[model samples]
Target chain A: DTAVSQTPKYLVTQMGNDKSIKCEQNLGHDTMYWYKQDSKKFLKIMFSYNNKELIINETVPNRFSPKSPDKAHLNLHINSLELGDSAVYFCASSPKIVGVQYFGPGTRLTVT
Target chain B: AQSVTQPDIHITVSEGASLELRCNYSYGATPYLFWYVQSPGQGLQLLLKYFSGDTLVQGIKGFEAEFKRSQSSFNLRKPSVHWSDAAEYFCAVGARLNRDDKIIFGKGTRLHILP
Candidate 1:
């Protein structure tokens, strides 16, 4: 079984459209994170949640929001998506904060 | 603030040749270092990590990394390179006292293997 998984591997939407990506981990971790990888392949942290509590919030725009209903799931929702929002979004989870993390297949968002 | 630097944007090595990827990090205290590999359109896979006890740590797929506190460097090396080893390598650093538990990642170095 996959340790971590994400839905909608690819998404293409027009400007101003809203989209969401779902992530789940079967590792029973206490922390989960979301990261964005630009076309240059530069990865940046977007948000992190620990036990359903928000922890790290980077300089990402407000259009992106992460929701964690439980420790095993973290979902990202993008509102009014712009061309700049198009990138690969990755979901990761770790046993705790500041340790090895497990990543899921990324969701590629294409904005037109 | 903690940061990771992977000076090389891309590196090319012949198959069966030895390979080394340099990584340098800046942190106030002892840092948790990690090396991850990401294949095209795939997710990141942990190559190795160095927390404590050992300066040299072995990882999956015949990969290894050495951590040098004096130089603030944790470089990944392989005795031999294979075609499947071609991928993006990222070095990350995590501060032990960091409350938010965020790991700073390098821009990533793309590895190319020549046939």
Candidate 2:
């Protein structure tokens, strides 16, 4: 079984369009996180949810919002996407707040 | 603030050659360290981690890392390099706040293997 999975592996949308990326993990973890990797391969943490509660919100823009319906699922929604939003988004889950994180295959989003 | 730094952006090593990737962190207290490898068009995979005991920690794919408190460095090393090892390496630092956890990842170092 796939430990972690993300839907719509590749997303290509026009500027000003809104899109959402869904992530699900079957590792039965309590902590889930979202990360963005820019073209330069610089990975930065965006948000983290522990048991469906927001724990860390790194200086992400308001347009980007993360919603966790349950501990197993965390989805990212971006509004009025801009060119800068074109990057690979990854979802990770850890058993504990500071445990080893298991990452999904990643979703590549392109805003043109 | 906690931050991880990888000085070398890229490194090339011949096959069967010993390899080492440098990683440094800036934190007030002892921090949780990790080394992850990411192949092209793939997600990051944890190679090894250091929490407390044993400065030298072994990981999958014949990779190991040593944590040095004096220098705040956790460098990953391998006895021999394989072409499959050609990928991007990331060093990360995890810190526990009062009621939260924060993880910072370095920009990453790309590894290239030569025949």
Q: Give the candidate number with the greatest DockQ.
A: 1
Evaluated against the true structure, the overall lDDT of model 1 is 0.95
Query: What is the DockQ score of candidate 2, to 2 decimals?
Result: 0.81
For each candidate, the alpha-carbon lDDT, in order, equals: 0.95, 0.95
In angstroms, the error of model 1 at A105 is 0.3
TM-score against native, each model:
0.98, 0.98
**How well does model 2 score by local distance difference test?**
0.95
Query: Which pairs clash (backbone N, Cα, C closer than 3 Å) in model 1?
Result: none
Native-structure RMSD, model 2: 0.7
TM-score of chain A of 2: 0.99
Model 1, A4-54: lDDT tens per residue?
A: 999989999999999999999999999999999999999999999999999
Worst 10 residues of 2 chain B by lDDT: B95-104
User: How far does residue A84 in candidate 2 sit from its true spot (Å)?
Assistant: 0.6
- Clashing pairs in model 2, backbone N/Cα/C closer than 3 A: none
Candidate 1's C-alpha runs over 4 A off are none
